[model samples]
Target chain A: MINIKKLALLIVFIWPSVLLAETMEVTLLYVGPTDSQAWAGSQQGLDEANLQGQFLGQNYQIKSVTMKELQDLPASNMTAILVDASKKNVLSLAQDAKYSQVPIFNLTSTDDALRSACVPNLFNILPSDQMDKDAIAQWQAKNPDIAVKAQAWHEDFVKFAASQLNKRFKRNHNVNMTDDAWAGWASVKMISDTVARTESIKSTSLLEHLKNDLSFDGQKGDTATFRETGQLRQIVLLVNDKNEIVAEAPLRGVKNGLDSLGKTTCQ
Target chain B: MKFKSLLLSTLIMASTAAMAEPSHRVFISNEKSDSVSVIDMKTNAVIKTINVGERPRGIGLSPDGDKLYIAVSEENAIAVVDLKTLQLEKKLDAGDDPETFDVAPNGYIYLSNEDDAQASVIDPKSGKVIETIPVGIEPEGVAVSPDGSLVLVTSESTNMVHVIDTAKHKVVKNILVAARPRGLAFNSDGSLAYSTSEVGNEVTVIDTKSLSIIKKASIDLKNSKPMDIKVSPDGKTLYVTTGRGNSVAVLDADTLEMKANVPVGKRVWGLGMSKDGSTLYTADGVSSTVSVVDTKTNKAIKTIEVGQFPWGVAVDD
Candidate 1:
């Protein structure tokens, strides 16, 4: 004779486990080549998160798919998608995933147009570009001499400093202003550091862990955090045209930090 | 009595089912944590944590694995650890911001200091900086020539691989690579050296004999940001970790074509092959763990949790 009640309870308890045992596949849409230093830094974070074996009991098979292949991928089987910042076409992909109600995570600098135009399904794992701007500004405040010295050598130096300063002042501080590899590498290093601190890999729990626990030793000079509103509070470096780092500034804040550019008109 | 006996046997089997090999010692350099978490590979547990200088990035084991050299960026020094005693034996001052380094065949260490724009040759025995050879701006990645006669340093700002004559301690030639060149690896045969460019998203193959970039293979990782490059023991496949692409791009050494994308952790940076060449280990800097990939399957088998901000990894025989 079968014990129907006990059997039913057992089935209910084991059903989720059975489903979890079936490995979930997540596709990461990278904006740059997997080998790019900045993107590789982010990929390392995602790989470490998957290794924690927390999301689904079985490991999540992370597939690095191209932006072109995103349309061809079967969105139905994907558990989640992480988009690197370098991917210029993230907005379109986020829009496509929004209809499917799939979570789209952005780990690069946030685009305002994408954030406002796209649905709420898009979540940024990194801080906004404004945070980087603020970090540079704050650093400038502390190191006026270095800033002045860099400004004096501005013409001979490379174009990183004047452009960085102009961007922060003009309220158009895009990181693309300079060709300083150190600034770029520094940003990658910050994100990499954040990803490495992740303790768990479960999707739902990992998301929470990233949101609450993840913090980076930003290039700008202070610890950066990815806030709930998808804004990051960190330091931004001010480089001169000579390609020398002149100043470091703090950007966004959770409690005591500066507000987002959208919230303030500091420029 | 029979059921009890069966249960006992099953319990014993279950307990030993996943028993791993005795833990080998693993030293993890935590950049943010500024400490090295020592884990016994046999138990896969952190045995102890040793604090080094500020912002420890690159790490390497001596030829005998008795000493560990830690690159302390902020301090502009390399801290040497006596592995057997697990004690900080000495600190060798390199140039400014020593990021990555490689060991020479003669037991000397070559380090790339980005800020100083030079590669310092250090004699590990004396704990002294033997020579400072100016290479390029933001000199980051370094590898010793298989013959030990030369050392190559990649300058990101200059986009050139400066080949240093080990004996002369001067730049022999500046081989132009693509933009933002970083990681370097010499093939097993020493016939060719592979360099990864972060911005160019390509691997430049340099023929050591000719001292020129003989072939340039594009690593078509969508948003592919190539980091460190390592050649397999057989010297058939070239493994490159893509920073943006979140995967290890395998290249057929002979064909110089894209072979496969072995997905790994986010921002895969430093990479090493096991002594036997059966397994590949990547330091997942962002994930703060090491992803162990089976060379045969070309798939990640397990992720070993290590110290905070795990950037560089080295395997001991």
Candidate 2:
């Protein structure tokens, strides 16, 4: 009848002081080295959340963990894990986080695997490659001249930019296609801004806000956010030989010519 | 009783005379509101609202106090405001995503373009881009040395501090720092420069002459996400705003230690120190308020509500 061992374990792990501490400890898992620009930028965002008291009464702590670290981490103790879209290790990290029931925020380049995998807690800030393609198409519908130019230039630039990006994409099965990769930077900025606005350092709330209300004002001028299903409302831009910009054809949500560009691409 | 009353009246009259001196004007850029709110020094009231570009951020006044420059991130340009008329005089193309800037003593303006990953040097008189010095990734913050010989730029993406020679307009060296370095400020002596790393939640102290990070002081706040950094004129204290924390973290400049965290409005994006260096003004983006802090007491003296999403801030004496 006496359960002294269980009581001692509970006291050590669930003490009120540890639970009600002023600072919330959060560990962010990144797929790449912490020094990389993209990961470094994300780390900065986490630091900003801590500085601003977003995790009030909860000290915000971040540890840049790689794929190897994912295996070693006690998942139940981690607040959230952020995976880079371009990283080859993303799939493993996502799978591990899913098994452990740890929430994952993906800054991925595609949505096929995420949607197909159907992880309830997995969310992405960046739109998929298809969304980028569709965004350009919607934009083309609005500016026919720009669309024509983009179509003409696509043949020239696609070969070079695609080849450069394909090396990494091929290694990550989750990535099926490549749009304007420059959108990656915009996505990072958008997510950081959203995190700053929501002021929710908690992993759960941050994930929810990113999925529901965070609208990405991409470099290509698309104002769209991610859906619960992990699809994004995005505008795609096709780059030409001269590195000039354009929108593609066969728009999704065009009602009239004037409102063509304003159409949302989220599924 | 009559003599005592006369003395009291005389004392009150003297105090009123001293208070009658003109108060300095603090200018705030409301990014979401797309306007700059000018606050009167004495009354702490918004004196005027001037419209700028799409998203007004990184505001600064010329040394002469005759002109004000606002970096419009959305528009990818800078709006020059004539202090006399309080009207936008001209819009200058400043590469891409012009966020922060520093005005040199020689009337040249050095601005960091976040998108272009470069710093554009502008001749204020002509409003022309003299030279664009390519540095590290996402150059967000810039500061010029007191002697105007060297310019320092903080690259958020690359996590490096680029030191540039003013004469040649070229990056001489790159000093690595903590993550997401956004804010840059130089000490009065120009011997040292302070940079705020948003991701690192720390302030990096750099030896200007050596261009090396001497030490890093961790700011003790949850997100201590320091954005805009301003050194007092006396050079005794450093003021940093936690963009997400909605508060200002003060540090002793000499000791390089965190002194206090004074609460401000939501999302304090930009900060400005008064000409006298006694008062600090911060633009609260979300709460739409400018929290005025008395430097000596290190407390929020007044909160002047302004346009929606106030961003950059400047002071005119």
Candidate 3:
């Protein structure tokens, strides 16, 4: 004695909800506490992309996982992963056989060694240490008067950068920008830019676009493109705690197209 | 000795008076110094630095060559400099954040306000705003046609060129271009306009009549960031300043072909041509100098050091 009218209404209400809930999952691997400043920036970028509906005809389901959670998951389904882990974890995860086919955006690490590691699937969103060093060198060459010495302690600079981010971060959670935070924000933006260009949800298509035809507007008033070494070539700005631009690297004086600041040729 | 002094005085007076139309003075706006550098063509020297105000950019002269209008960006006003006296005559209240402007043939000045996202049409004589036409975001470059019927404003963020009807002060058409279109130039006939895309590393030519992009040509130099563009008086050649490449790219205007890439000073941004159109002057911001390029030989003849960060240049002709 099935009630036909009641069953039909239940089917009509439940089926669209199931279809609507279907979304493209973007996994974020957090090595440390999610509340940290570095992870906060990346989260902000993901939220922005979701609000903007950057992906074509699809909704983004952001799934943030801890290192333990990531390791426990079945690795075969990994499509795209954003790595907000320590340099060591980033290196190990990149080489891990489980996520070999997955495209990973390295958000927190700037170690030059990561670039030399020929992981075809890994892309560095932030400028590498060598790239930043070269930029400083170029700036020093142009402006010999500015004594740009490499110091071990610049906690104040990080605080200032974080404050700058805090002003822009509109959500209920506010965090200062650390190296990881800046990298996270930049990495999400780089992916969003590539996705916007490709207009495809398939991971292979996105990876192809990132490797071959990706030029991201890093929101630094300039466009940054990937080098052969998987490093992002961009204009690095040196600023003080007051958020004033002290100097910009790849300064106007660096001759022969070196002002773009990175590896010129692609690998 | 007395006769020699008398002859010297006579020579000076005669030279000053004879320097009438097609004058050999090049004026450059220095952003950091808040002044204008006046270069003497004969001596190839900066003879004067006139204090204008904060962030003076986009220098252009009236058709009569008696007045020079400078976009003082910080003050949100246009400073009119009297060329004869070499002094600031008055300030006209333009829109907010005026980055660049051009003088129409009908004597009206079209200015692009970067933050305001609109262009102010100001009558230079009366110092009154004719109208403010809303345009795209972050308008950086402004160009008026030779016939003065229309003006083009390039918005960097929007990546579109707003073709404005000068008579009605309305946007006639919106032609999309490459990323970060900074500066533009028009041919002698007002039939074609060439715009430089800073990030795209390309130049787009717009057919004025059709309001369509005729063609786009990529800059061949490695890591080229083409910023400012200028066409020759005869419209035979196009000169584009590659910002990061530190060179001026020469192109065939008609064929849209790359002819030469002349190396100049570091970080060349603005360009000015001599009155005779035989020399090209580059306002090199990073080098703090202006490189003079001989058009015939396509070589840098001289580099005259100027104020800090010279942003724009104009010739008195």
Top of the candidates by TM-score = 3
> What's the TM-score of chain A alone for every prediction?
0.50, 0.54, 0.75
Worst 10 residues of 1 chain A by lDDT: A148-157
* Poorest lDDT segment (10 consecutive residues) of candidate 2 chain A: A152-161
Comparing 1 with 2 on lDDT, the higher-scoring candidate is 2
Using DockQ as the measure, the top candidate is 3
Writing each residue's lDDT as its tens digit, candidate 2 over B1-317 gives: 99999999999998875443323788888887888898998999999999997988888877666788888888988899887788899998877778789888787889988656689998877878999987765678889999999999987655568899998998877775655678998988898899987765678889987778888887888646778898887788889999878899988987778898899999787888876788898988889999999988899999999998888888776
Ranking of predictions according to DockQ: 3, 2, 1
Comparing candidate 2 with candidate 3, which one achieves the higher TM-score? 3
TM-score of chain B of each: 0.89, 0.90, 0.92
Q: Report the C-alpha lDDT of model 1 over B191-221, residue by residue, as the tens digit.
A: 8999998766779989988889888877876
In model 1, where do residues sit more than 4 Å from their true spots?
A1-267, B1-24, B39-45
lDDT of 2 at B230: 88
Which model scores highest in lDDT? Answer: 3
lDDT of 2 by residue, A1-267 (tens): 258988988898889867666454444555555544445445434433343333233234456665666677665565566666453355555665343355566664464556445555665545454445555666655666653222211222332122222332233323323332233333344444444455444556665666665644332222345555554544334565466543333354565322332223223
Candidate 2 residue B92 Cα shift, in angstroms, is: 2.2
Which pairs, if any, clash in model 3?
A: A38-A181, A162-A177, A228-A266, A228-A267
- Which is superior by TM-score, 1 or 2? 2
